[model samples]
Target chain A: MLEKTGLPTDDDLKKVIPDKERLAKGAVVIIECFQKIPCDPCAISCQFGAIKPFKDINDLPQVDFNKCTGCGICISACPGLAIFVIDNNYSENKALIKLPYEMLPLPEKGKEVYALDRAGKIVSKAKVVRVQKIKNKTNIISISVHKNMAMKVRSIKVEDKKNEG
Target chain B: MKKTNLAIIGGGPAGLSAAICAASSGAKITLIDDSLELGGQLIKQTHKFFGSKKQFAGIRGIEIAKNLLQEIKKYKNIELIGNATVTGYYEDGILTIVQGSNGDIFIKLLPDRIIVATGASENMLTFVNNDLPGVYGAGAVQTLMNLYGVVPGNNVLMVGAGNIGLIVSYQLLQAGIKVEAIVEALPRIGGYLVHASKIRRLGVPIYTSHSLKEVYGNDGVEKAVISEINKDFEFIPGTEKELKVDTVCLAVGLSPLSDLLWQAGCQMKYIAELGGYVALRDDHMKSSLDNIYIAGDVAGIEEASSAMLEGKIAGLNAAVSLGYRVDNFLELNRNLRKELEELRANPLSEKVKIGLEKALLKREVDQ
Candidate 1:
């Protein structure tokens, strides 16, 4: 389904999502990479021993949820931009999602934007909470969305006037 | 006439790695490239590479080129020749080169060993008005935007769903250009899903099982027509759709630039899976001729990581053939081979594996 639609199917997402108990706790990393490509940067970038060591470079990353602190260091390190950090305990009705953003005109903090789902459909309105520009061009942007839309919102679109430039 | 132990043609990732490996093992090297600066296509790639850590996984291609150049600088035995083109390689072991701004300078080299690492050229598609001024290859677009910071056009239609097409679309957005859509002839997206997802979430629609019907304009591209295709690649008559765009980028595929190998008379075969004609070589990358070596896209179309690994193998083997004293030669050679095997072990590399099987020549028992 991912090959045809370019978006992971529910079955694909089911394999990588943390259990309900883990989600209720705090922030955790979600790797949406389902292919067997020859890459292992996530394991190397993780400070904690959450991502298991890759027996072969082509092996998919195996994350140990117990050790995962969801520091979000691996978000920008992924070349595919397939990794994300979800914090369900952000607020009573809001959740925070950290994603890799490489586009220009970085969204200003506290600015409202349209949050999009996997297929790029507008799902909800979100506010930018954090924008960390790393040494690499892949910057990390965290947005606070409705708690029910935490897993669905994967990207944000800013409608600033300057973006027309 | 100038002479060296090993002469590397094309200063891309493969050639740079070859020069560094051979030079470190005491084989004086002359690394030649047509561009004034080195790094070939890598200098223009903005996206990070995907491979193991040893191959610099998660590092941008531009940074990888920088690291290779810095590593090459450490080898005093290595000499770099820029703005120089290797014109011909004669049977008598002489290579003619043309250098200088006007290409008026002529030079000859009689190196003991020659490694051909010439890369690839982008393939163009056939369609009405494809020759318009606004039409461009993906590589040209990358060179223009990433290298010179020049945006190609306001709106564009990409003609492939491969990694290059997807990545270039993302880059165009970064450059503030609007991507109308992407059309691919295949039913399923040919590139990695992650790359497709990256662009899709940004609102660029990819039309699989679709082909560019035509482009129409007076002096430049003003609009494009695309239509859905069937399993046999036949265009569906009523499925045509028009998109207004100033530029059309073709990222269909690439063919190996193996003219030097053909001139050298190394046994060659046309392998569609490999992207074109490639030189038949052994595991060490030695061509039919004892002193001739081949690597990178010239040997077979593959990723930069595999190309770098092949370069190391070819460089070390070429040096060893010249009696260079490398204490751990066998061990290093085995490790490089293992790494290359691991890199190509995935299902994505199935085509490359099939191509290699046909191009790989068996080594004789008596060297």
Candidate 2:
């Protein structure tokens, strides 16, 4: 018998996805922390208190969209690299996405990168707008992709050395 | 025989924290490790940790090791010794440690209190061609890729779906290594869902109810074959599929290294939940043997965070036994236990609870 595999499905995504109004407002946090594990660095990293304190360590984090300023500090603070900030209001045809990146040869600002979805398939072309290496642990990289690709994109393709050469 | 107040067997997170805490409590501490540098497995863990700030959350494991090493250096009473292996623990708190590469140097230490924190060893799956050179432990892969910057192989087949398997799969991607697949005999992912999600999102297929049946190669691992298994873990007929891969990484499980505990005559019991035979210890981490304590994986296999907490408790209590007045010992112990409880309260921690209960039951029986 097949059992629950733990990967997020569309149904699971619906639970943590920001509302239409919040998504349209341009800045929102999408927490993909599906498991009830003992982790809460995201809550403490949020300066606006948007991420509520977990009643229990295994409790799912609740995000008050109103208080969330989308400062993106929690992007790097998340040990799981599951917290993401998306802004649909970047432009009429583009959206901004900030993800935790930890690979070497960090992507540079204004560089073109391939945005990959949950399955790691290249979904759209994206441009790196910002790369912040905080405390040399989790690096927060913000990229601008097509508005429709904002919700689908999770990571940027790291250029392989051999491929680069 | 030189006398010391305390002798800590391992210098990983547990031993490092114990050395710092014990030394701070006025006990002369001698911390010895088998590695050239300290930080046991922490040296290879590149991912950030999750916990409260008090536990140094948001910090990478490598950074945590560096910070702990720096903190331990502050105490003049604690002596840090690397490249030393504790060969044996004998009667009267005597420890025979062989130092140097050739094991030529022998040092006999007689400490009033001994803390066994000698971590654990990775478990390997038994199968055809399992002895091939390319077949490596998941920890060895991390040590090679993350620590030594050597790519384990171009293509890898991870043979476990636990935290180590999932985390190593992600790290393999970080090192630009391709993970062909992860085959687990369990019906579902055994680790945290977040870890499984991370690797799944990276397009790594996790095959549950599947087991690595054979590793095919002559000089090294050239390919691997997996098959579906039944509830009894018996391989189903006509379900085998060969995976083209160069490396077969095993993350089956970890067995606690409790040889010294047994040699020292500490009461040991076979507890499957604790991942093998473990020394019986009270909540204070003191074994049935007087002045001998156990912590970290040596006591039971658990996360680094819990191991560090166990080390601190054992260290504080050991100091107290050594006539050191630890002002906040009780309060600190209570808080540490609370934090450990919080970390272990998840539904997935039911097994951990069972393991802890078995170990604790033995402790009560001994008392």
Candidate 3:
């Protein structure tokens, strides 16, 4: 399904998503990597040992949700940009999602942007909460969206004034 | 004529790694490259590499080039010659090199050992008006944008959805350029699903089972016509779609640049899986010729990580053959081979593994 549409299927997400108790607890990391490729930066960059050591370099990353503090350090380290951190307990009706942002002209903190789902459709309007730029150019952006849309929203589109119709 | 222990042609990842490895064993190495800069294609790669830490995974290719150059600088025995192209490898054991902006100067070297890591060249697609002024290869696009900081065009129609196409499409978006679409002949994307997902989530559409029918323009590219292809790669009638775009990028594939090897009289085999004709070499990267070695894409088309490992193997063996002392030679050789095996263990590398099997020659007797 992923090869056909270029979007991970629901079945793929079910294997990596944290359970209800872990979601209710606090922030945690979710690795969306599906295929086996020779990549291990997520395992090497984890400071808390949440991501288990790879027996082989080609093994997909497996994270122990209980050990993960959702610090978002490994978000930018993923070469495929397939890692994210979500805090379902951010507020009564809102959740915080930290995703890798690599496009130019970084959106300002607290700016409102269109939150997009895995299929790249605008699902809801979200507010940018934090913008952390690291030396490697893969910046980390934190956005606040409705609690129900947390899992669906995976990217953002900064509304350009010139492109507005 | 000047002489050295080893001469490496091409200052790309493969040649640079070979120089570092051989120089560490106290062998005098002369590394030559045609480009003014030393990194070859690695200099233009902006995306992070995928592999373990030994290959600099998670680091950008541009950064890896810098690191390799820095490593080469620490070894005083390795001399770098940039903007110099090795013209021919003579049967009399002499290599003719042409340097200078106009290629007026000529120099000859008679090294005890030679390691050819000339890399590969991009393959072009055949379609009507494909030679238009605006048409470009994926490597050209990367060189223009990542190296020279010049955007190729406002909008681009990409052909071939392999890793190069997908990564270039993402890079185009990063540079604030618009990607019209990506067309691949295969029904499924040939690149990693994650790379496709990266651009898909950014609002780029990848059309599978589609091939570029043609491009039309007076002086430059104005539009592209694409149609769905069947299992045999033939276009399906009445399924044509036209897209408005200014540029077209071809990322079909690459063929090994093994001209020097052919000239040097190394046993060659035409392996389609390896991208083209590649030199047959032993486990240690030694060619049929006693003092000649091959590594990287020159031996077979593979990822930069594998190229680096091959360069290490070739360099170590080349130096050892020249009677240079290396600490724990067998252990080092075994570890390098094991790392290479691990790198190619994934299913994605199946094609490369098969190609390597055919290109690798078995020793009749251990030297």
Candidate 4:
């Protein structure tokens, strides 16, 4: 019961991922919402109507990468913090991943930090590129990590505990 | 004796929204809360809420609380009294209360309509050494960390994998506290998959079909013992594992605190879905006894979004009963109910649906 639903499997992740070619072009959204819950902020947040509305309130939100300019509004709009924006064409060897970060002392731009994978384990070193604080104090942070870790890196590790507050 | 058109108990999402609505309807409203600060659980909820824009979706709970407070201030007819505890509801809608920073002052209010939204209390799990100081409820952990900015402990053992349990575990991590494990007695995690995934991605192991056997410590909880359970929920020997931790957070469930409703002589029914014996309410959220209404957790243990919708309905209905006219009242009520149904359409709320059905059936039989 805690299998695919709780921790989504690789197949579940595959179903929600956008086109590989489009993702590599930069600015594509990844929505990991698997359950049929009554939430639609992600759909409404999109100015370009990239996110499709649910026939039923419980239907999972679907994203069209073609229309999705990846304005990153949906990142902070998601209550579950499940939506993310990835730019695979950031640089020659780096890709940028923008994730919803609500923690204190937002990571400093250009500061190198430990990039973590889906399991939160340190996978690679990354540099913070941008931090955007939207409505309700939800911060959207874009970090540059190795191109290979684009999909793997989901969060940045803050080691210094004292600065958290 | 202080007089008002309506009196709302509890300063949570329900009461706050209700007060705002009733005041907007040209009703004199008096909102009372026990806490020095308002917002109930919203004050400690840093996470963004999920719902439509009407319910303030995409907004953090703290911000919603602030907006509600600001909105309430716009109406001069609405008076908010903090640091006030409602002690009793007596004859003819009279309310006995203790109001002061320390509750040293006493007063009685006579209001035409009363809305009880006292909310719910955390259900504690019974195990050896569970009474230790380190064994805290999930709400206590949130209040300590999010509200007071004090981390409960370094290493913690979470008991239950419900929404509250999972959310609190994630929050503890955000507060720099280490959650050793989340043990659930049930065969599966009871919370939403999204919430479970958030903590799982953080490397926190969630153990279903497992129960905490004992919590061992001297002055406080220093360690916890857990074991797997069989179909009958009996402990399976040789499956015991000891986890060294300083805190144990119980997030098993919550029971509605409906003592005020029960004492007010409203007909009560034991509806498990509504979280124990709660006052039976009609479609308008009015109690069996006229002039007494219920909303929020007092009606059932549901989400804050549902509570706000329920509060709006009750507030409008209470205002109407007091001869106050609200524009397009029926239309507004219908829309709120429709939104609530949409929110409860998820499979996770099936139990709540069943409970509500039973309560509605019982109410019909009485009618």
lDDT of 1 at B41: 81
Per-residue CA lDDT of candidate 4, range A41-77, in tens? 9888899889987676777898888998877898888
Candidate 1 lDDT tens digits, A1-165: 688668888899999999999999999999999988899999999999899889999999999988999899999889899999999999999999999999777889999888999877898899999999999889999999999999999998888676556
Scored by Cα lDDT, where does model 4 land? 0.87
Ranked by TM-score, top first: 3, 1, 2, 4
Instruction: Give the per-residue lDDT of model 1 (tens digit) for B249-330.
Output: 9999989999988998999999998999999999999998888999899888888989999999999999999999887999
A1-165, model 2: which lDDT tens digit per residue? 112465677888999988899889878898898777778888988899899987877677899998888889988888888889999999999999998887777888988988888767788789999989888568899999988898789988866566886
Q: Write the per-residue lDDT of candidate 4 for residues B1-367, one digit (tens) a residue.
A: 9999999999999999899888888999999999979999998887778877778988878899999999988999998888999999887678999989777999999999899999999997889988998999999999999889999899999999988998999899888789999998988888877788778777788889899999888999889999999979999999999999999999999999999988898888999877898887888889888899899998999999999999998999999998899999899989988988999998878999898876652444644
Interface RMSD of 2: 2.3
> Number of clashing residue pairs in every model?
0, 1, 0, 0
Question: Clashing pairs in model 2?
Answer: A26-A87
Candidate 3 backbone collisions, by pair: none
**Number of the predicted model whose lDDT against the real structure is largest:** 3
Per-residue lDDT tens digits of candidate 3, residues B137-234?
A: 99999999998999999999999898999999999999989999999998988898889998998888899999999999999999999999999999
Candidate 2, residues B1-367: lDDT per residue as tens digits?
7778999999998998888888888889999899998998888988777666777777889999999999998999998678999999876568898999898988999999999999999887889989998999999999899888999899999989888888899899888789999999989888767777667667788899999999888789998999999999999999999999999999999999999888888889888888898988888899888788988988888888888888888898899898998888889889888888888888777887898887873433434
Instruction: Write down the worst ten-residue block by lDDT for model 1 chain B.
Output: B358-367
- Cα error, candidate 2, residue B209 (Å): 1.8
Candidate 1 vs 3: which has more lDDT:
3
Off by over 4 Å in 4: A1-5, A133-135, A161-165, B361-367
Q: What residue runs in model 3 are displaced by over 4 Å at the alpha carbon?
A: A161-165
Compute the interface RMSD for candidate 4. Answer: 2.1
lDDT of 3 at B139: 94
**Model 2, DockQ value?**
0.57
